[model samples]
Target: MSAPRVFVVENTLAKMAREPGGRNAEAAVKAAELRIDGVKDVSLASLIEKAEQLGVLAAEARASGESEAFGPVYDLSNAIYGVAGAFGLKGLAEAAFSLCDLTDHFRSGEEANWPAIDVHVDGIRLLATLGEKATAAGADSVLDGLRKVRARVMPAN
Candidate 1:
């Protein structure tokens, strides 16, 4: 039999990140969807699936008090930010990237540099909740802190 066909998700997040703000939210979303759809012809589907496995690894490291072993976890988060940024979702992207950096920093033998994981989790949850509220309010589209974030990431936009 021939090799099975695979899919790869496009990196729309990176594209969106470069756009920033209301100017490109819709385009970012649409591009993201298209990127997701592209996974049918490559290995991106497998790559996404691996995220679950990585989560398990991260949990194990955390449980074992081997926080320094979280480098891989940070890499994964950074990858997500790259896509988010491409899609003009700078707020979400930055948050994710920052979390990765913080995690890695603490994991790398840096004393007094540990981040508050709980706070990051709460912030992410709040952003999601706010996005839902905005959608409910019939807002055109909602990306929390994107307006401010975009200004920083894509100043020209």
Candidate 2:
């Protein structure tokens, strides 16, 4: 297995951190980095170790209800989707995107939407698992998750 590419994720984090709402959002970015470390079929022990270093801080911020952190997470997560797409990991990418979007939706005024968001997050974790084992399948799994979210959020015509 090849190392997961960090190109998109890194840049995405930088961009997201610039937002006025990024103070809390930064935690999500770190959390997402922690997530990337766990990618399967890839020897990311080094990355995982790094994630461990930051995970505690990120977790604390999240637990503190620094809701602004949602922005960074969404940004980083979206970038992950793009990376997945570039590597033909559409399922994994889409699933990640779905979770990001769900988080955004919840932040943007859908306070009572965790049930749906939880479903999306679950799909994202599954896709991430796939990414650890099969990059391509993981990307596609992400795409599928995104589609599911879209189906629920998009207006029926």
TM-score of every model?
A: 0.43, 0.46
- Model 1, backbone clash pairs (residues 3+ apart or across chains), number: 22
> Deviation in angstroms for 105 in model 1?
1.1
**Displacement of the residue 80 alpha carbon in candidate 1, Å:** 1.2
Question: How does model 2 fare in lDDT?
Answer: 0.55
* lDDT per residue as tens, model 1, 1-157: 8999888889998887677455566887898879865753333333344344445655665666766567776776677566545544444455556557566666876532223443343343343233323232232222344334433433462
TM-score of 1: 0.43
Query: Which one wins on lDDT?
Result: 2
What does candidate 2's lDDT look like per residue over 1-157, in tens digits?
7988766345887676687764465788888877765663253232233223323433443565656755665665565566655455556555656656666765575543444545555555555444556556555555665676667874356
Q: Each candidate's root-mean-square deviation in Å?
A: 14.7, 16.6
